[model samples]
Target: MKDAAFNQLTHARRYFEAKSAVYDENARGWYGRLTDALLSQALDLSVFSRLPDGFRFLDVGGGAGRWTERIATANPESSGVLLDVSPGMVRHAERRATRCGYAHRVRHINGDVDEAGELLAGMTFDLIINTHHLLGFFHSPDLVLGSIVPLLTDHGLMVSVLPSRWHAAFGDLSVGDAERARRSLSGLSWEAHEAPYGHLFTPGEVRMLHTSSKLTVDLLTGFPCLIYPDPPGVASPSAESAEDFLRDDTFFREVLAMETELLIDPDAGARGANLFVVASRVQPAEA
Candidate 1:
């Protein structure tokens, strides 16, 4: 690896290690709830029912194994392997698996995705998930995709959640950092002080990346489309009120329902805070 990339990777590892204990706390916030809800819609558990028993899944860059646990619990016959860069996060993931009583079915690896090919050699998954902006962590999306795509079974599926370029630009604009916003829109990787540098992509760019890798884009959409670009720190109505609403399961369900409808809007990819994509190995041409 090059010196700059290695340094960046080291920086990200240290950051996640320090934040490991509190990393799952993000799921407690309204934003986190909405994000997960959106991702769940894309997941559509019904698809998993079609796979044979003891199907395998891999969660790339899955921290603390939250999503892995959810999938494993839902599909009792399924097993999972969670690969992450932070040992602290990997430790927490192991504990989560044990506490959840499915440790036997789940494995944790402490390593970076850049080394995923070597680390997970000879292992292929029926389903591969790259969630929580995993693509943002690397300098090259192709490098990440190339290493991971080959680890999929012939008919396997890969679901990816990518941080939106437009969302980052809007976030910078909301913070009155016009320069940063411009850079974001220009597609340059940038980092906040003490934060890991990340790459953000438009939906089109995402499609291009996968298709170039010989994977067919199956589904591409955005979540929380109706409530995004709401300016930094401000919730839909008010912070306190949003917090109250977030606590109300009924209210959250209603909001998610409305957002789901809006997610199919042709422009949702550009308007949403993040992009969700499902892809698979390109099908061979029939004679």
Candidate 2:
């Protein structure tokens, strides 16, 4: 017998919630800046060219609703649903939503993501975001991509950031060390948590989705994806693929927003923590 995946996630969430107070007191707030920057980049409203005044979005497995809160705040045009398998995290997300004052603008669901349909039944959204590769939540990512992809409005887009073990950038942590960390997580979800760099993805990996998934890869960027260059640790249950401590200045942010992938997308350069990919659920253009 073994611990269930949901149980494991619950444990992780509980651990973070327990430490949340300490993090608030002494954690340097490093995690907060890194997470905010990473999510803001992925949901780039700039790329949309003509973002609507109001839209609906979903944050799958969004713990504490951190990213959702930020995205909704920046784009008041957006309202959302925050779904997580952990009831504890869902509570945090609700509290965050309320503080962000998007409480009336969002819905919160507590259940297994494998049972997402019951939560998503009869609904559609303009954008679906899974910051930090929420892909790890499912035993079958194909199911996640299949069931949820259809929930998007025809022109809607789905953006996912996953951990890729085969990445161009490995940070200060050597591949061997990363592999060890992965193997330490036990079986099953080790894939979601440590191994495969927690479902960290490489280029073209998204092609493995179900045929009905209907999402076409639009753009992918691997950025400060990790804070390792800055070499510290990751926020528990919060996944923002970022590398070291790049200064938070606009110039550096712009450079990171621009240059991270130029080095890694096709090959490797200095190395990055995580990669960001944007996909659109649309039919191919006619010839």
Candidate 3:
């Protein structure tokens, strides 16, 4: 299992390295925009208001430094470090920061999160952002959270975006297609339809992972309740077709609005396309 995991990570790194040059352009479609908006909302609700000036920020698997750039601009007094396993991605992020004149405020590291302790020796952060379903790449959530928990300050927080297992199984089913939805759900598990490195998780599994790492879950919310078509699955849409579908600004805006509203209910996480979790270091008991 360990060998397989390593091989998967290696393959993923190579794949991303090849995609690095065109990643930003490829991600400029409607789905990408919607995901960004949802994540921005999550960050605003969970971390932005409570963020202290001059706090240290860490972005795990922060490909191309997009989110890091946003965080840096939002918190000008704060410093940030962006880490990714792909060197190509690290270079892209570096270039992006230089272009945005934030090079001085952000440091880019090309390393795996599993070995973050050595890569980030003697460093502790106040805020850690791990979006884009980064946790899915690790062999185990415990390994990922274990490395992260020790790197956070006593009051530090980690915000992670995870793919929802329930959504993976049924989110694409037609609203009234009870038969199909039931069939899909019956076969679904935490490991169903897993990619070479990515893994989906249920809400309960997410909570367990955090608790095992000595972290406390502060919030777990759903995002983008309804955006894609049903039956084939959310990942079924091709990028070109998705872009074409979003060309109608009016339709896009309307759907975005509806999805945003649906995300408000806490139970939405149980069936949404993705989940955002905010966890903080476990506080010690006072004598």
Candidate 4:
């Protein structure tokens, strides 16, 4: 890897390492619940449900093995490998695997995606899980994708959740920052949360990435489209208020139902805060 790229990865590693202790804390909130609902809905698809016994999986950029453990636990016969840049996260992932009593079925690698080719050399996975804006943090998403795509078997599938380019743009507009919004729409980095290396993507852009990697887009949609619903007589809801509203069991259920339905919208990819994709390696034509 180039020195410049390596330096960026170092920065990302430090950021995640600092958050590793509380990495899974986000899963405790209403948004976390909504995220779980949508991802669970996606995993229910036939492609994931019908995997053969003893299938191998890889969780790229999976911190603390939250989703990795979930998937591995659900498929008792399957084994998994989790690769992350932060050693702290990898340590937590190892502990989770042991606590879940599947230590033998899983392994953890403390390395960046830039070194994935060397680290995961000669191994192919039936399922590759990349979630939580993993692609956005990369300086060269294409390079990372290229490295990982080859590790996917011809019949393998990759499930990913990437930050939506338009979502970031809309977020800027919501704050009345027309300049930032314009930059976002023009494909400039929004520098989200002061992370300069972050790069969001449009649906079309993601599809093109798959095409270039010789992968087939099996499913693509947006998730959690209804993040903050307006309440009666209120035009703008603060984060606390939104959380309080979603805390009501009935409202939570209703919102989850609505978000699940939004997954089917053709334009959901463009409309959603995050883009959910399930793609597979292109199969060779039969003679």
Shift in Å, residue 77, candidate 1: 0.5
**Weakest 10 consecutive residues of candidate 3 by summed lDDT:** 187-196
Q: Which candidate model has the greater TM-score, 2 or 3?
A: 3
Q: Write the per-residue lDDT of candidate 3 for residues 1-287, one digit (tens) a residue.
A: 44543434675687678878666645556777777877786787678877677999999989888899889887788897999988989999999899888899888999977678888889999999888678766556666667677889888898998877677656434444555455444433233332333566778888998999888998877877766433334343455455567668887787777766765567777767778898898888999
Output the better candidate (3/4) by lDDT. Answer: 4
lDDT rank order: 4, 1, 3, 2
Candidate maximizing TM-score: 4
Q: At residue 270, give the lDDT of candidate 2.
A: 20
Number of clashing pairs per prediction, in order: 0, 19, 2, 0
In terms of lDDT, the best-performing candidate is 4
Candidate 2, TM-score vs. the true structure? 0.71
Model 4 TM = 0.90
Error of 4 at 209 (Å): 0.7
**lDDT for each residue of candidate 2 in 238-257, tens digit (9 for 90 to 100):** 34333333344664466555
lDDT for each candidate structure? 0.78, 0.58, 0.75, 0.79
Error of 1 at 161 (Å): 0.5
TM-score of each: 0.89, 0.71, 0.83, 0.90
Give the number of colliding residue pairs in candidate 1: 0
Indicate the residue-level lDDT of 17 in model 2.
54
Which of candidates 1 and 2 is the stronger one according to lDDT? 1
Ranking by TM-score: 4, 1, 3, 2
